[model samples]
Target: MIWKEILIRYGELSTKGRNKKDFINRLRANIRHLFSDIAPLEIVSERDRMHIKIENDEQYEVLMKKLPTVFGIQSFSPVAVCSKELDDMKKLSLIIMEQFKEQEITFKVEVRRSDKTFPLESHEIQREIGGHVLRNNPNISVQVKKPDVELRIEVRQDAIYMMAQIIQGAGGMPVGSNGKSLLMLSGGIDSPVAGYLLMKRGVRLEAIHFFSPPYTSDNSLEKVKVLANELTKFGANIRLHVIPFTEIQVLIKDRVPSNTIMTTTRRMMMRIADKLREEIGALGIVTGESLGQVASQTLESLTAINDVSNTPILRPLIAFDKLEIIDIAEQIGTYETSIQPFEDCCTIFTPANPKTKPKVEKVTYYESFTEFDELIERAVRNREVYKFPEVNQVKDKFEGLL
Candidate 1:
């Protein structure tokens, strides 16, 4: 056969004290779920690593797309399987090298013979394979330290495997290992990045987005939906809860002074998110609030927001600078979409001078203007839930809660 199998290297899963099997099993299921539509495969969870064997060669393209996004996978390689003989390995090494382009290649061969009695030691196998690769590909040279390609050869009881290139993965614990959280998703850059970082830490996420219609068009809501969909590529099944925020915004603006409007609005959003978090059994709530990024994100403003939600608030970008957060946003494919000029609830009706040092008591005073208990209940009742991959289309009931 031409393409033999895929080898998966585990990250933190390898260091677990007593729960390593649990992590491996979770990772196996994750990989299988990601690959289910793409291929029929068998997963072999070994002592320290995992192997994925595909049913047909046609699934290679699908694997290339899906494998890199599976969390907990440190790296993966498409390896060629050979017989447990040095000559068989040498022959396959050349074939692996043929896949390398005409550009100058500096190479090294690393051999791990797990079967102690197979005759040739690791170094001996490396030497024989390295020499043959040098002779056959005249333009290619060897670099003992950090070569262009580190060709790997592994000898085990069943077969000999060789591969040249390694693909890096998402590299966190598998999703679903950590308890669920509610991501306070926005059309802006930071929240999407926050969701990504949490997912990387194995926290399964259901996202909540605040949409103010007319003040915020359907276009604005759709932008956040697209952002959540992009996150699915990283292996998260996100549900974007689009909450009608127009009436809440108008209520705060009409009853409160401009300076406290932003803080009060944030507190309302937090209250609604907290209620939803409990309903969904989420352990905490996540937000995009960076320290002092906006008036409503100031230390005092944050305190005002936190006062409303008993659930733990997870601000993944709390300490990050804007550029640092943007860099991650760009890397995770959410940067361009976040920078789009569609206003979500947070941006519209922003007061010129929101309270930077808002007190819990002052925020509470203005919150009394509108008896918001009924409004919050209504917002939650009318919330539209868009579970990604399946709910690709945001329904026509976009004008609800108006």
Candidate 2:
């Protein structure tokens, strides 16, 4: 029988032991919801691994493209059919090997006979396949530890699966499994990476972008929108809030001390982010602030910023260096876009020697001169909100493709 299935590998979830079944069930439900439009795919649980099977091949391919974005799966393989017994498994392995027999390479048979009742054990089957392949094609070498190609045969209760490759998955717990946060997204290298990491941990994200258009150009705003679009590939459609930060920034520069301008602005930003988070049902706020990554990220400065946030502020990148953050940014396809020479509102103002540590009382003194609270309220109330849908925009929701 030729049927398509998705094999899922969990990471830290397996450590849950007795609680593993609960996680698996939740993961299955999440997967089903994400692929709701494609087909009715049932998730089959087997010990620590989970397999997804659909009625048709087209649905399998569609799910393959979508499931990699899912958080729980470490890697997946698309396999062909076989039987549980030794001879049928070897026949299928030989046929698959013949397709790649001539290449100058090494190969090994990896067997996971879940059913011990099968006549031969996993190691015995691996050796038998190695012997058969060597007998048919003398030039191929037998390398056990690691090989250029691994022909895997998994023996299950109902069927045997064979495949030559494994596809990498998004790798993390399922989204919503960790709860939700509002990410402070800037049109720069760091914040998107921060959001990506949060999502990897199964944290659902909504974004708040501070824009100083005219000072920060239309291209800068568009750059942020593009960045959000790129991130949607990982899952969960994002609702991005664009706020007019230019006015507030100018007020801070003029009213506050030059040394404290950056700190004061960050404090105001935290206050505004907290309000936005409360309105949107987010449990906390996320930032890309890494320790010693920048002047404003200093402990004293962060403390001043934190004072305004009654809600928890999560800095996922707090301990990571610039190089480490950049390395991951490159891996997740955001580095190229992030490194673009477009300035966002955060960098446009004149604060060459901003304060590394700021006092809350001093910032309060500066705010006394202007009605800053009113300005923040207006900015949040009149913010331009855009929602990027989770499903790909092949067509409009009702109209369909033309």
Candidate 3:
């Protein structure tokens, strides 16, 4: 029988041993949810490997596209499965080698004999399959190290699978394995990468973006939503909160010193973010801040801003350099969307010569210049909420994002 399946490989989850079943089940659920629209016939997982069977050939490309974004998967491959016996595997190996038979190139046959009760050892099976493939096509030569084609045979208890290629996956802990956090997702390179890093560590996220509608266009808010959508591909759903921030920016500028506005603005943002954390039942608030990267990101500046924080603050990119953060942004598929010219609330209300060494007491004294508590409450109360789901946007809710 000609059977089509995709083989999935995982990384650190293999080390879980007795607890591995829980991790495997979580990863399996993540894969199923992310590819809910693709609709595979069944996802059969055993030991450290998973095999996804499809009913039609058309689902191949769709499944391939979704697999790369599913965390906990180290790699995957499309395969043709056959019976567990030796002759059946050799016959299948010969057919699998036909794709490379057209070109005169170096190749290797690798065998993973999991069931040792069979007649041949791993190297013996490789030699036998290699000889059989070469006899059918003289154009193929042998190479041990690296080759144009590496035909693989996996001997499992139930069946033997054959494939010639492997595709890389996102490679991280399953999202939701860890608790959730509130991501301060700005329309910039660092925040998205920060969210990506936290997601890699298994932290699920709900993002909050501040938008000044008249000062910043709806197009800019849409850009932020696009970045949020890019993140959901990494095995987590993002419920985005868009806050009306023009009033806050104007108040900070009107009542605060020009040099201290950046620090004061961030303090208010932290306050609002902390409130969001409590309201949404998040463990902490995460940001893209790097040390001395900007006026507000300085150690002293961060301390002053975080003074008003009621919840813990997590800055994953705190020590990362610009290029390092950019590298992760590109790797996680959010760099292009982040680089879009649409500006965000953070870019508004220019503060020339902003305070890099802001003190909490001084920031407190500055806030005393105006009554700001009512406005922070107003911003949070007027916020719009959106949930980006894994499938069926209408039923699962991707409000305002569609």
lDDT of each: 0.85, 0.80, 0.84
Task: Provide the lowest-lDDT 10-residue window in model 3.
Answer: 390-399
Q: What's the distance in Å from true for residue 5, model 3?
A: 1.8
Candidate 1 Cα deviation (angstroms), residue 53: 0.5
Deviation from native of the Cα of residue 386 in model 2, angstroms:
1.4
**How would the candidate models be sorted by lDDT, starting from the highest?**
1, 3, 2
Better of 1 and 2 by TM-score: 1
Write candidate 1's Cα lDDT for 1-402 as tens digits: 567688889977898878888888888887777776765687889868998886576677788778887888899899788898777878888899997758698989887878898888888888899999999998799998999899998888898888998999889888878889999998899999999989888899999988888898777787788888888877657888989888989988899888888888888999999999989999999998999888888888898889987789998889999999999998888897787777888877787767899989977987786799999999999999988865435543223423
Per-prediction backbone clash count: 0, 0, 0
Instruction: Please identify model 1 stretches exceeding 4 Å from their true place.
Output: 391-402
- Candidate 2 structure quality by residue, lDDT tens digits, 1-402: 244576777766777778777767767877876777775667788777887775786787787778787787788776667766668867877776776766877888888878788788888888887888878876578787788888888887888888776778888877777888999999788899999989888788999999886888776776677678767767667889999988999888888888888888888888889888989999989999998778899898888889877898888899998999999889877787777777887886757788887777887787788888888998899899988753455332213211
Top model number, TM-score: 1
Clashing pairs in 2: none
Structural RMSD, model 2: 4.3
